[model samples]
Every structure is written in structure tokens, then in C-alpha cells.
Target: MLSLTRRIREEILVIDRQTGEQIVIAPTAYRGNQVKIGIEASDRFKILRRELQGRERGPGPG
Candidate 1:
């Protein structure tokens, strides 16, 4: 894992060289020890929390 320090509104981007797709993340808010982040990515990407990665998926309410 790579770690870097970023101030609020400063962005870090990750790109896929093969597909030319990218994700931009930034720190939007911070209070005490908690932080709120903002991410910008295309619809082709699926983003989820680390804790929910292994959970099974089911249909949502209709």
C-alpha cells in the first residue's frame, strides 16, 4: 500500500494504463479523528467499502 499526505481539496488519482480509466479521490472534510472523502469515477467502476467486499449480493427492494 502507498501512503501520502494530502490537504483538504487536494486530489490523488489512480489510472488504469490499459483502459485509460481513472479515479480521483480527495479529502473533503475532517473533524477530530474522522475524515470525509470524495471520489470521482466513471459508471464503469464499482466502488464499495472494504468490509463489504466479501458479502454476497442480493436483489434490492422493488
Candidate 2:
């Protein structure tokens, strides 16, 4: 994965539409377009780690 370059800070919150529960996530640029999908802490960490690892390893085998 290529570097994002820009350092954008934003918060992600998961809320139960029916139950009215709220979960606030750390500020990360990777939250783009998926903020409404209800991302958990573990999921966020996995995504961030994978993203960083991919950037370091470059593209996958074709």
C-alpha cells in the first residue's frame, strides 16, 4: 500500500440504531467511507496493522 501522505484526523463512532449505543474510536485517516459500518476496536487495529504491513511489503503477487 502506498503512503497516505496527508495526516487527516477524525473520530469514528459506532452506534446501535435500535438500542442507542455509542462507541467512539480513535482518530485515524483509514476510517474513510466505513465510519457507518460499525467498526470495533479489534477490527480497527487489524485494518491499521494490515494497511501498514501492506505499505511496507508493497503489492501482492499477481
Q: How much lDDT does each candidate structure score? A: 0.95, 0.49
The positional error of residue 39 in candidate 1, measured at the CA in angstroms, is 0.8
Q: Candidate 2: misplaced stretches above 4 Å?
A: 1-9, 28-62
Residue-level lDDT of model 1, residues 1-62, one tens digit each, is 99989999999999999998889999999999999999999999989999999999899999
RMSD in angstroms between candidate 1 and the native structure over all alpha carbons: 1.6
lDDT of 2 by residue, 1-62 (tens): 33333333444565769966666554343454542323455332444544476566668899
Which portions of model 1 miss their true places by more than 4 Å? 57-62
User: Ten consecutive residues with minimal summed lDDT in candidate 1?
Assistant: 43-52
Q: How many collisions per candidate?
A: 0, 0
Clashing pairs in 1: none
Instruction: Give candidate 1's TM-score.
Output: 0.85
TM-score: which candidate is best? 1
RMSD of 2: 11.6
